[model samples]
Target: MRVVSLVPSLTEAVAATAPGLLVGATAWCTHPAGLDAVRIGGTKNPDVPAITALAPDLVIANEEENREPDLTALRAAGIEVLVTEVRTLEQAFSELERVLVHACGLDRPRWLDEAGTAWWDLPAPPEASRAVVPIWRRPWMVLGRDTFAGDVLSRLGVENLYAGHADRYPRVPVDDLCAAAPDLVVLPDEPYVFTADDGPEAFPGLPSALVSGRHLTWYGPSLAEAPAVLGAALRAARP
Candidate 1:
């Protein structure tokens, strides 16, 4: 079945589950590379005409990625639309299972079970007891509260310093980050591409490291392989 994915994470899911089935996708959908398929548009503003012209059998999107108006329009157009909303690890796994079931018409893969096993088996990072994972720079946005990233950190036995905050993705002053002074600072490698060179000069004494944004931040089938990568990164950043 031909598919058009408007959400980046769903794009990754579809590609992983059924590769060549994707006929169109957004520019931001860059997982499972070599998907030179049609560029629908961005997350917020998909090229409706272009997508309509593709006439895909299914169009996948995310509640967080696409705007309501566009989703409404797509639904009005009578396109079979599947929307995914992933806020926690359980939600992520559910979304993955849903996508796999929809795309392949089968039961959820054993990968999910294996992923759970890997997560449960890993020894919690000692120094990561209190950590803050920064996903963006510029205005300094962070994964806050009960977000998927926060849940992943929690499962690894790491405490998210911002998990106490009310906002899910909060933009705070660098001074606030300095004040939190977490045991470890996790700088994700996308959105803002924070690297070790960026350092923690703002926090002075915190140990920091650059981590894979896709592994730590994305919520999809990729989660199956993320724990090990995150575990090693957290271990290396231990104070």
Candidate 2:
């Protein structure tokens, strides 16, 4: 079956599970490097006409990563779109299963089980550290309540300061974030690339943990190594 994926994580998952099933994907779907799928466009503003023209049997998307209008347009074109909502780690596993087995009609990939085992095997973290996780910096948007990244950090013992906020990704002033006084500043390198020289300077007093955005944000094969990678970064940033 031919598939076009708007989500990078889902694209990687599908690509890893069943090669050649992906006929098209967003330009951001950079995982499993050297992927040969046709580039549709970015997740938020995908080329609808181009995607419909691909004549894919299935178009996979995510509720948070994709726009409603784009999904509507794809559906209007009579394309079978599978939209997955993943607010927590468990939901991610379930959705991955649904997408591969139910949507693509393939057996569950071994990597899925390995990813689950990787997280489940982790020992409970010692007292959790409070942190402000900034995904973007032009206006300073942070991971707020019910976010997949927030849940991932929680598992790694880094509590998100903005997790109580009403909006999932809340934009806060830089001064306000500094004033909140988190123990650490967790920076992911995607949506915005926060380098050691670039992002750490903003939080002068606090230790900043620069992390891999794919491992921290994307719910795919990278998940198998996320716990170790994020945990090490968080630990290195600790005083």
Clashes of each: 0, 0
- Colliding pairs, model 2: none
Model 1 per-residue lDDT tens digits across residues 1-239: 88899877778776766677789999988887787589988988898888888888888888877888887888788788888888788888777788778554756666677876776677755544787777777788887877777888788768888887889889988878878867778888877877766746655778886678888878766777898888788778777
Q: Candidate 2, which segments miss by more than 4 Å at Cα?
A: none
Q: Residue by residue across 1-239, what tens digits does model 2's lDDT show?
A: 99999999999999899978999999999988999999999999999999999999999999989999999999999999999999999999999999999999999899999999999999999688899999998889999999999999999898889999999999999899999999999999998999999999999989999999999889999999999998999999977
**Predictions: Cα RMSD each:** 2.0, 0.9
TM-score of 1: 0.90
Residue 14 of candidate 1: its Cα lDDT?
Answer: 68
How far in Å is the alpha carbon of 36 misplaced in model 2? 0.9
* Candidate 1 colliding pairs: none
